[model samples]
Target: MEIQSTKKLVFLLLFLPIIYTTAQPLIHHHLTILNDKAALLAFKDAITEDSQAVLADWQNSSNVCNFTGVVCNYQQNRVEQLRLNGGGIHGPLSPFLSNLTGLRLLDLSENNLVGPIPPELSSLWRLNELNLFGNLLHGPIPDSLSLLSGLFFIDLKGNHLTGIIPSSILYNCTSLGYIDLSENALHGEIPPEIGNRLLSLMFLQLYSNNLSGKLPPSLSNCTILKWLDVENNSLSGELPTQTVSRWKLLELLLLSNNLFTSHDHNTNLAPFFSALSNCTHLQGIELAGMGLGGQLPTTIDQLGMNLSSIYLQDNQIFGSIPPTIVNLSNLMVLNLSSNLLNGTIPDKIGRLQNLQSLILANNLLIGPIPPSIGQIDRLSQLDLSKNRLSGEVPGNLGNLTLLSDLFLQENKLSGISPSIGRCESLNKLDVSFNRLTAIPKEIFGLTLMENFLNLSHNLINGPLPLELSNMKSVHEIDLSSNSFHGSIFPQLEGCAAARMINLSHNSLEGKLPSMLELPENLESLDISFNSLSGEIPVSLGGSLSLVQLNLSYNDFNGPIPTSGRFTNFTSLSFLGNPHICGSIPGVPVCK
Candidate 1:
């Protein structure tokens, strides 16, 4: 019996070490899971308000892996992902999340989380994606985020983050492929250390920030880059011709609203345009409001066939609309407004059949609008206003059944064609500040004019159309500075959604229609500089939404009703009407 016991003891001693070795990792696995559970609990506690109850199951669940938005590894031992996006949870981000050492993704976007990003997040050594976008979080981006050397994507966009793009992140986070720190308060130059560093970066959106200074030339080293949006920044320097030429895979480039100058005294943009041709996949290019000078290069068509949108408005771009632009079969939106552009719009512009929005307003372009524009069946918005263009609008434009807005104001348009009424989808039509005469009867049929119907500052004559009442949902109607003669049409009261109604500076005669009831949303009314003579309508004073009123140079006599929200109106609102009387300051006292 003694010999048998000695043998068993030896066997037990040998098995004990093997058993302990095998059990060590199992013990560690449970402890790590427990730590993960604690981290999640802390996260849930940080949420002061979870109106949507997104985290309701978080507390009740026994296993942390089964909790809301938490994903565990295949072994069910560690948390790997936590996706709590757009849950309406209002709270500060918990720094305890860093304890989830094995976490690969942490997406807490579109929440109301406020406060600085916790620096402890750098401890997430295995994190691949960290998206905290669309939160109200304020303060500088934690520089220690660079410690996540293996991170591939990090988006902190739409936050209140302030400070420079840290040089450490640009220089060290080389594995990053996507970085969007846009729509924040980040200021300072993009660190030059990023030369050839972020070779895997495909997208870099730093738009709508306060970033200034010359774009580092080294950024061109990110050869695989697909999107680069640095618009709305105070960045100054010549267009980066050398830098852009290297972005062969670039798709979209928005460098607008910056202080960039063209090479060669701001007159030479050819180099920049030439460099852009290298990016065969380029689709959209927006350089608007950059104060760029020089003519639109005829070679602009070399910007690739995939290019769809080009916005170069609010600049000093001159020269005629190059017909070569029609060669880009995929072009969708072309906005060249508010520039010094002259010469007639290329008549061939209509060939861009896929075009949706075409804005050439506020330029010096003369000649009639090419009727060819109507050929773009997909055209939704067309703005050719504030130009020296003459002649009538091409009736074919009415072919655009999808047209929502057509702005031809501040031009020398001769007349409104009945064809415009064919645009049944028209939401807003502004032909103000033009020499327009003859209102097409079809205009009265545009009931979808919910935005505005402005024919002001024109030579249009004739009585106000009773058909105007058909615009039941029109927001504003301005036929002022015209020669319309007749009594104000009482049928106009049918426009119950009208907010602003201005028929001033016309030749209308007689009192306002006695049944002229104010619309529910009526805010402003101007009928001054007319020949109307009678007691002012008492309904005008009782306007609930009326804030601005003008009845000047008229022959109206009456006691202004002190009712509703119109009492705030002063004498200026009733000026030049010798018979007008009101108790409001600057108004003639009622007798």
Candidate 2:
């Protein structure tokens, strides 16, 4: 028995070492996994709202590899990716995220997460993509973010982050291909080193920031850049002429709402257009509201063949609509509003078949609107308002089946076209401040006009069409300042969405519409300067939503009831109608 015991002890000692050695790696792997699981739990606890149960699967009893929004490397047993985008999660981002040391991709975008971005994220050396867009995160973007040398993509748009963009990111992060920090409160000049270091970057969106200063000339070095948007900033000074001319691969260049001035010595846009002509691949250019003053170059015809959109509105550009502009057959949007452009719209303007929006409002454009405009089959929005355009409106405009918004107000257009009734998709129709003797019956057939129907400041005369009842969705109807001589149509009450009705300054006579059954949302009623005669409708005074009621210059003879909305108005609302007496201040009490 003694000899057996000795042998057993020797055997136990020798084999115990081998057993422990064999299990060592397995034990270490388990500990690593446990650590990851704890980190994930901490992350879940940090989120205040996970309404979709996006993290409901995160439990201690389950395998960490199977947890929601977590991806683990089977070989290394570590979390490699975490995605919880648009999960309705709200709260400060947890600094514990740094514990996921092996993470390669992290996307928590489109969530309601508030608070500053965790500066600890700089520790993610292996992270390739980091997207936290559409969050409520505030504070200056941390300079430490430049430490992510391997990161190739980063998007932090739509946040409240303020402060100068750290220049270190442009000097470092050489692997970056895409960087979008747009729609934030970021300020300061963009670092010129961006073009020098990030040679591989293809996209850079820094629009809607408070960034000021001239664009860096070094940007010309980024030959591979495809998109550059610095719009809606305070950026001032001349645009980099050499850089724009050199962007051969550029597809989109949006620099709108800035203070950029033309660098051309002649104050002619010819040089700028000449420079852009070098970019054959350019598809869109927006320089609106930049106070750029110059004549649009006739050489604009020489621009990129693929150019699809051009927004140069709210500038000081003068000159006629260059006939050469027809060369851009691919143009989908052309907005030249609020400028000094004049002359007739080119007769060949219809050549742009892809036009979805053509805005030329608030210009000095004269002559008849070209009938060729009807050729744009894809026309959706047409704004020719505040122009001096004369002659009858082109009846062919009705050919636009997809036309949704038509603004020809403040023009000299005459004779309403019945063809307009063919526009089934019309949402808003305005032809005010024009010359017309009769309301086109076809105009009232627009059932889809939910925005408003304005025919004010026109010479239109006739009875109120019963067809008004068809406009159930119309929100406002303005037939004021016309020559319409008739009683208020009872059918007007059918416009259930009408929030405002202005029929003042017309020749409307006889008793007011017996019922005036306005929509519950009715806020304003202006029937002043007309011949409407009757006892004030008792219902008008009781309206809860009525805020402004102008019944002056009418023939109303009765006591204005002092209740509801009427109690709030002064006697001015009942002025010019001597027959009107009420409890309203400055007005005699009714006998």
Clashing pairs in 1: none
Models 1 onward score TM values of: 0.96, 0.93
lDDT of 2 at 62: 97
Every model's Cα RMSD, please?
2.0, 2.5
lDDT agreement of model 2 with the native: 0.88
Pick by lDDT: which candidate is best?
Answer: 1
Give the per-residue lDDT digits (tens) of candidate 1, residues 1-591: 999999999999989999999999999998999999999989888888645367887763588878889999958589999999888889888899999999999999998998999999999999999999999999988889999999999999999999889989878889999999999999999998686688888999999999989888888888898999999999998999998999999899999999999988998778899999999999999999987998878898999899999999999888887889898889999999999989999999998999999999999999998999989999999999999989988999889999999999998889767998999999999999999878988998998779999999999999888889889989999999999999987666689899999999999999886667877888888898999988877777666778888888888888766776656877777777778677777777886
Cα distance off (Å), candidate 1, residue 418: 0.4
Where is the poorest 10-residue window by lDDT in model 2? 263-272
Name model 2 segments beyond 4 Å from true.
1-25, 49-53, 513-516, 539-544, 562-569
Whole-model Cα lDDT of every candidate shown, in order: 0.89, 0.88
lDDT of 2 at 440: 78
Error of 1 at 163 (Å): 2.2
